[model samples]
Target: MTPPAVVEIDHRDPALQAAFCDYVPRVFRTVDFRRWCEWGEWNDDYRAFAVLDEGRVVANASVMRMRLRIEGREVIGYQLGAVGCVPSHRGRGLSRGVMSAALESCGEAPVLLFANKNVLGFYPRFGFKPWEQALFGAAFHAVPGGEPAPVLDLVEAHVREGLVSLSEEGLAVTERFGSRGHARIASWYAANAFSRPLRQLHADAWVFAGVENGTLYIDDIFAREPFDPRPHIPRLIDQPITAVHFGFTPERWWPWAGVAGEDSEAYLFVRNLGPPSGPHRFPVMART
Candidate 1:
């Protein structure tokens, strides 16, 4: 049996750097490869590994950092992301090699990720456990007929007229919650939006500013203790919204169901990236 040649990659090493530069289009195409190449060059929290065959790159994966504050404690975790094996190496077990190496290194902080149900089934044998609610679909609220009301129009108008676009607005919103609310959203565009400016790198994300899908999905947003996502759902007493799919707490969400006929619920399969039985409080940012 030929042993797989798998080892951690130093992003700066010329050989491994060339491998990453080559695979961006095949593995992930949403963001330009240059950004990841830059990420490799700039970020210290990222780690990578490549599977080599007789001194040539065949597969690679990366471990990136995600910082979350849960229950008043600052939890800095490693997220297993940007994993892809070469087409020729698909059935060669190179994935397990890279995953095993990444899992072996996580010490104190728990590691996590979100994969489709089929992929989730593959991680458990490696000592990962499926943590419920570790994956959550949007807690949705159907607007009255799925159309933005006058108030929503005003909000869009603010951005369209390009009047309330400034970092000052974003700063004011940051105090409410980290970065997951409407206030923070408005602030995000005001500050990082390309057309506007506060932070440089995020300016490209501003296209989401004027985009009102007429649907609001609150996923890992303002997560409170016992994972109670019910009351946090904005109550629409007199308003006419079609439905609201509350998060994991479907029981508490019953009142919300009254707003619509039948709310759809979607959950993701979550598997831990640590020991056989470890802390399962892995945040939703695994998929973020």
Candidate 2:
């Protein structure tokens, strides 16, 4: 068998980067390639690894530098995404080679990823173990005399600035959870998740959300201080939302009235390179 050449492309190289983006859709057709490229937190530091067979890109993996709060301290973390292998190259070990390269680059930093159901057994070979995640859902209610919350376009500059403020505040509160690691929100996350920021009654507070299937998903709630989201829920959504779902749990809040459900589509797996700890929990917003 002929060996495939493996190379890492810097996102700054326009020609190589465009080819990488174009290749991803062959495996993941559910998302709009152009928009998916714009989604998530990406920067010049991000590395895209590809396996070239006779100079054509076939297998790919993405390694991203991320910040996470670990054991009450801010630390650099890594996330792996965009893992795919062209259909014709399925049994070539190209996907494994690309992932090995991505994990090697992570070194000792903690690594996390969401894997498709079919590939759930693939990551275990690399020391990654499946972790159960809890999803909380509750019936939506209206607050008397509440005004509708305006949805701001995340692509706009001013709106992104506001999201930054909320994210910073949210991170600060996340520290109090100690021992849990949460991915810090980047400016591009809003675009990736198609999130909108809603105005809160409290000055400088905002709720980030996205809608699907008549349900409003609360990605994250940010405020100068921790506060109850129930009171502001009515004003934060304009549609006749059937229920409100918590994506990530903020400090001091638990889904007491909500039912817990398991995520059957995607499974979270982690390979801890740092200290040995118990199962870690991250909010839905942190899912990359």
lDDT of 2 by residue, 1-288 (tens): 655567898755666776787787788875323553454334554788899765567998887676666557776777787898989989988998899888988997788888988888899999988776556677765433466666666566566656656665554434421222222333345545545554455656666665666677776665666677676666766556677776653334443535447655548787884432433335555565
lDDT of each: 0.40, 0.64
The local lDDT score (0 to 100) that residue 251 gets in candidate 2 is 37
Q: Give the candidate number with the greatest TM-score.
A: 2
Regions of candidate 2 where Cα sits further than 4 Å from its true position: 1-3, 36-41, 53-56, 138-140, 168-203, 210-216, 239-243, 253-259, 273-281
Predicted model with the maximum lDDT: 2
The backbone clash count of each candidate, in order, is 1, 1
Task: Candidate 1: give the clashing pairs.
Answer: 194-203
TM-score of 1: 0.51
- TM-scores of the models, in the order given: 0.51, 0.79
Query: 1-288 in candidate 1: lDDT tens per residue?
Result: 565767776545666666665664565554233432442222455566668766666676666554433333435666566566767778888888878777666655666654544355676666556544422234345323322211122124344223234221221111211122222223322232221122111221121211133433322222122233333223221243333432222222132332222222212222342222311223221232
